[model samples]
Target: MRIKRPVKVFLLGMVAIVLLWVIHSYHFQNQQFQTDRASTYSELPVAATKVVKHAFGEVTIPVKPQRIIVLNDISLLDPVLSLGIKPIGTVSYLPQYDFLFRGVTNAEAAGIEIVGIGNQPILEKVLLLKPDVILMREYQRSLYQQLSAIAPTVVIDLPSLNYSFKENLRFIAQVLGETEKAEQVIAQYYERVKQLQQLMGERLKKIEVSVINVFTDGIIATYSDNETYNQVLQDIGIPLIPALAKQKETSLFLNIEVLNKYDADILFVMSESKNAALSFSQNPLLSTLKAAKNHRVYTVQQDRWWTYGFLGVNKLLDDLFKYLT
Candidate 1:
């Protein structure tokens, strides 16, 4: 029953080594946790000021803003929502254009107050809200001084060149310290595009797509290079009709006679109202177009198709998936 001294000594040594290894591992992990916590806090100091270059020179903003007021530019709604931050006040769009606020199902539940309309924001209402930061577009420059007096105003200038929905989201994210979330959102969006492409197969490359808005007055067709919806379609690998190849400075209002030139394998018609759809359908040339004849013409909501933002793009994608697939 006697154990060998040498074997017992070796066993004791092994036990000591294992205990030391466990303690070292625990201390290393604890130190690593503290280091990570310190790094995160350092990156986001309370009351930290970050200088952001916007449309109107440079402005310093808090690293973490509590109350944000989004004015005029409803496009920022999507990015703000994605970042999981609620703005204290926002400008209201027209009722017909409610799709601009699509995906925000519980605005009332979340306490998002509409302070005013895009063109005419009620400054008195905004002043009551007392937002910490104000986000707006350059077009609202007239109200800059007043808004700045109320809070730190950051004006986002729509970039003329290489501007995409993702770029816009990144700008908003940078202001809110949600750059990581912005990247994730962009990646998820492209992944959805990839899924749609897979479902579409070769048709994604060969199909000619056209996006046009039907109004009582006339039709406005958009080109791929400039328009946000068309740009997304181009990214999904759909080819644009030759007529839409050259970018116009703005959306072109075409008469019915020239509408046939822009006909495509698939047509997305953004109708202003039910009457507009009816009128567009009644056009004599409607039956002759390939998309119309084949029943591939989709009557989409004008707001959902025209609005420039992450949510709008995703809604457009949803419609494409519903119809094309």
Candidate 2:
């Protein structure tokens, strides 16, 4: 048997190709192990640019904010969590209510540190946490400068208790770069709204409703045309009393006698249960209103109405429909 040089060369070339392929495969596997894909839960794709406006000033949010702090309302917390981002801290103004975290895990597991109770967040403590941004309501703008000096803060004020929860959820979703989640949430809310609207519109016959807020001190406050709740009422085809329809000059205390000036078919009174129940039970004047006489007076809890965030509005609408029917 004669050994040919070309055959020897061919055998060596085949061995080299096999070894190279094995090495390439091993390297690829190692690269994948180093690049972690487990933690990314739909992070925003675009670079978070500077949002500047006359009212909000300049806010620099990382297109993807890893750490966040929530102040003011706990109601808005659920949507943030729903978007797959957790807050490092939150306010403990009301401890008992749990509507906001319906689908979230146990409070202990959620691990949301309590930053402060009622008054605005402790500026010093929040600065220490080094949050990328802070969430706040509109009235809290007084602390704008102090907060902005520490980190970017978003001041949200949706006019009217009737402010569409879906719209609100969408606004927040946009801010958090969770447009898909927002769309899904809004769609669900809309479905509920449509069903309620159909039923309430048919049975109530476009009845007028008024949302009143009362304090323990005998001061009465009713929603103005611009309030979010009013918008919710209008959405269901409910009419607002003439005076309420005309936006109030102010948002603060008014006397119960003011209710007389703006009469409506249904009256939605909001206040602390203890105080509202006491007023309705004891105050002859409050009991004299037409709605009260007919038992149309529905007392809603302030905490629930005030803090329900985006989904809260839907709950409110559902309640209204239930009351109307």
TM-score against truth, every candidate: 0.80, 0.69
What are the per-residue Cα lDDT tens digits for candidate 1 across 236-293? 8887887787755566776766778878989888876788888988988888899998
Error of 2 at 188 (Å): 1.9
lDDT of 1: 0.78
For candidate 2, the 10 contiguous residues with the lowest summed lDDT are 100-109
Once fitted onto the true fold, the runs of candidate 2 whose alpha carbons sit more than 4 angstroms away are 1-54, 74-84, 94-110, 137-168, 250-252
TM-score of candidate 1 to 2 decimals:
0.80
Clashes of 1: 0
Task: Please report how far candidate 1 places residue 266 from its true position, in Å.
Answer: 0.4
Highest-TM-score candidate: 1
